[model samples]
Target: MTTAALGPNRTSRLAARRGRQRRWHRNRQPIGLLYVAPFAVLFAMFLVWPTIYGFYLSFTDRNLAGASAPSFVGLANYLEAFADQVVWRSMGNTVWFTVLTTIPLVILPLVVALLVNLNLRGQWFWRLAIFMPFLLASTVVSQIFTWLFNPDLGLINAALGSIGMTGPAWLQDPKTAMTAVVIATVWWTIGFNFLLFLAALQNIPAQIYEAASVDGASAWRQVFLITLPLIRRTVLLVVALQVLASIKVFDQIYQMTGGGPANSTRAILMYVYDTGFSNYRLGYASAISYIFFVIVVVLSLVQVRFFSRKADR
Candidate 1:
């Protein structure tokens, strides 16, 4: 065949191959979707539907005990939420809790992971000891700490007595209420972050450390230059996860303090619970929840953008 005729024939073959691949891909897509269909159904039924219904409820005056059907009140619930001092206070407490817990959750785990990763005696014991608390259910952990924080007979107070010092009421005193919660939270959840940091540490190549050692870099210097830089992504991930967890803190505080000490430790989620279930103000509670949800979503987006920029660099 002439070169021009051969070119047209080759083009037709290439087009045919591309068309077949496209058809195959199109055919496979439905199978892929079918495989995911169960999960999608459950997700839509539970998550998507509830979220949409909750958002709709936020704009109404739906009381569980009310005789009338829910009537739309436009922005009344949101406006009330904005003016609600308790809501604002609870939000402040949530922010305080997040700030108090984030540092320990991010940094302490890294330190513990570093220690456990060392060639020490009984490393397995140390790993188990650190992470065991994380495996405990929130109720179990809270009950344990409740006893420990007891003003008179608790171990913490007893230890203080041995030192000839008095331990203040932890769960009851307004001053110490959130502090006690923060302490329990840090102790309980640090293990999960520790395991994550340990995993990240293990993935670091030993040869990198050897190269640093050959260059006469001190251990601390090597950690600052090599270890931290390599595990920066993991550190960020732990921080983000910790922040979200801290913000959504309910079970521990609810079980331990019940938002007591004049509601000093009342977190946002606790406020939502009180509004919806306790007070029967479902509509207002939903509004408050949606507002908090928006805040969380915004924070997640910001974190994602920050990491994306860092990754790009």
Candidate 2:
């Protein structure tokens, strides 16, 4: 064939190959989409739909019974939420709970995990014992703690009495109720974070510690310089998880405190429940929920920013 003719033939073959590849790509697209369709459907139905619906509901004046007609009052519910003293009280309570719980949950678990990782007797038993609380249902744990915090027959007060200490009426008194609830929450949930830290600790290579030892570094110095810096990612993860979880804490406060003793322990979730169900103000409840969501998002962003800065350093 002539050189020009040969070039045209080669170009034609190349075009045909490209056309085949394009057809194959088009054919694969549907199968890939089909594989993901279930998750897409679920997300739309559960997460996306509810989120959109909740936002819509927040703008209207809907009642719990659905008997009254809803009137669209743009931002009125939100305004009411801000003006309402109970909402602020609930927000304050949630912030207090988050601060009270997050610190202990993040720090105590790390300390316990460190202790467990060291040479100890019956290490696996200690680990299992430490983690046993996480296996129980939240409601179940709350109920058990509820009885334990009971004023009259609770073993906790009895133990304190034996030790010459007058135990306060834990669940009944507002001052003690919130504190007791926080302590129970910390105990019940700390195990999971502890295990996470423990796993991160184990994944650190022993060679690093040996190298530190050869450099004549003390144990505490090794921890501060080597172990802590290396596990910074996991520590950040634990802190983020605890902070978020603590902010949204509901079940323990619900079951144990009932946001009771003059609503001193009423969290944002409890306020939402009271507004929607108890007072039959669905719109107000929805508005408060969105506000709470915003607060959570802002706090999460702060955590992320701090985490990023630490990582950069």
Clashes of each: 0, 0
Q: What is the lDDT for 263 in model 2? A: 87
> Can you write out model 2's per-residue Cα lDDT over 1-313, one digit (the tens) per residue?
5998899899999999999999999876768778889999999999999888889999999996878689999999999999999999999999999999989999999999888877579988988888999999989999899888888889899999999999999989988889999989988998999999999999999888899899999999988898888899999998888878888888989988789889889999999998999999889899999999887788778888989998889
Over 4 Å off in model 2, which ranges?
1-27
The most accurate candidate by lDDT is 1
TM-score of each: 0.91, 0.89
Question: How many clashes in candidate 2?
Answer: 0
Task: Provide C-alpha RMSD values for all models, in order.
Answer: 6.4, 8.3
Question: How does residue 22 of candidate 2 score in lDDT?
Answer: 96
Residue pairs in steric clash, candidate 2? Answer: none
